[model samples]
Target: MAVSNQEQTPVEAEERGARARTARLMLDTAVQLMQGGIVPSVSDVAEAAGVSRATAYRYFPSQAALVQAVVDEALGPILDWKSASVEATERVGDLLSSSLPRIDAFEATFRAALKLSLDQWAQRQAGTQGSEPQFTRGHRIDLLRDAVAPLRGRIPEAGLDRLGKALSLLFGIEALIVIKDIWGGSAEEAREVVLWAANALMAAAEAEADKS
Candidate 1:
């Protein structure tokens, strides 16, 4: 018996929905494990998610892949960052103010992601990471550029790039960890300090642009 196209369409849609649900379950489980400070392997995520190892591996073939998925999920909001401000400083401030709280909320997950990246770095340095894919980090670059987009015409291209680099230093989990953990500041204090530094850096960049 030949199956009609209409019948096959619904079947395909149902299959896709099931696959998406399973993937989401695995990702959510991986994130929860990361938040608990356990850098989960695919199999670990499978067990915690009550999914079969085979199924979980199908979604994320390696620890690096799994961890990256969780990191991307944790960064969903920040990645979608938007601001209505026309001023470069104001846009940067809005981005920081809105994102700092989110970063603090997922501090543990971000720390775990950072740990994985550092571990991969150390392994590569020691010539022990083997053929495993390295965990690279750099989402802040684009976000910072977007935050400072309003200054492109006003500042030189070099100045804009320098401003982005300076702002990146004060943007992500690294900054929060430094300000909160190393400096023993509270979350609010860290946010305040980062905003202050971010604005200061922008002001300096603008002044430098004026001079040039």
Candidate 2:
């Protein structure tokens, strides 16, 4: 079916532009609040952005929407990452090298996101989660699988999955926090350790594939 023309009228266009500006303002405010390690609600962002609660709610609708927008903004570059290397280990190293620093830079925001995820988990366990949307996290799974794509035909699917799970323990904000916070190591140390672990996992996967 040929789609009919549905262009907006001049007034409608102007209204859309205004709404877009307001949404951007609210989203920017949310990012700023999250950067301070605060998983802000829509009302919090509205107050910070000087926008009315009604208007902010119109754009974000819920805390889940607002926090998710901030996460997508923070995750933009890492999600778009691609490697030129053909070797699985080298590609994994490249990804870690490129992504760890970015993750470090947004450390506070990610930690705040993690806090939200954990809070939702606890609330759910207590049956007090109410209608609040649960915060979700698992981007590392797909990323790790892609990084290890070179082993697709070499290893069993279960082996590849296990490798992804193992490497995940060494990736993301948790890795940085464990190395930097618990062990009192620096960001560089975290990066080196993650890179080393990822390479080791790749080697293990390749060896397992050889046995198969």
Candidate 3:
């Protein structure tokens, strides 16, 4: 039984890859559970992943960590869309159109994440660091900027703030909740409504710029 450092390197790499794969699998399961209305707990996820509870805890030390991981895992495509739209479009309308479809695909996850947003805001207002989603407002603002870049010339500098507010109000989780929970739209319909509203806002901004 001889163990050499040289021979251990490949084995270590394999172990690392396996751990990464396992972590990813656990995250995937958590997302699916969330989508399925399961409200997945660490123990539930560990059971689903066939890992020990301690192993799950090692990867995600808290419920917030697990929830954030699910949110991040689901946003991969949205990030890609932002990157692509940032590169391809020269007009705001086109960029909005490009981004909306990606946003549509991930609307449910966004809605789920938004469920606690207002409570978090209230806590922050009260001077407590509340449990917020993994993503930050700055990240969302960056995404908004990316979606608006194509309209830079057409949307006046002064109007950018208004446009940002309009888009943020119309396209986010609260909007989804209003559509689904308050307004009684299905998830699919709510996404379509948000996309339509986003497109309309972009088009209106363009038209106003053209008039001026």
Give all candidates' CA lDDT scores.
Answer: 0.88, 0.87, 0.67
Worst window of 10 by summed lDDT in candidate 2: 1-10
Which sections of candidate 1 miss by over 4 Å? 1-10
Candidate 2 residues 87-134, lDDT tens each?
988888888888898898889999999999888988999999999877
Query: Distance (Å) between predicted and true CA of 25, model 2?
Result: 0.6
Poorest 10 consecutive residues of model 3 by lDDT? 86-95
- TM-score for each model: 0.92, 0.94, 0.68
Top candidate when judged by TM-score against the true structure:
2
Question: Which candidate, 1 or 3, has the higher TM-score?
Answer: 1
The CA-based lDDT of model 2 is what? 0.87
Residues 19-81, candidate 3: write the lDDT tens digits. 999888898888887776455668989999899999999998876678777776766655554
Q: Measured by TM-score, how close is model 2 to the native structure?
A: 0.94
Off by over 4 Å in 2: 1-6
Clashes of each: 0, 0, 2
Residue 133 alpha-carbon offset, candidate 3, angstroms: 9.0
Cα deviation of 8 in candidate 1 (Å)?
4.6
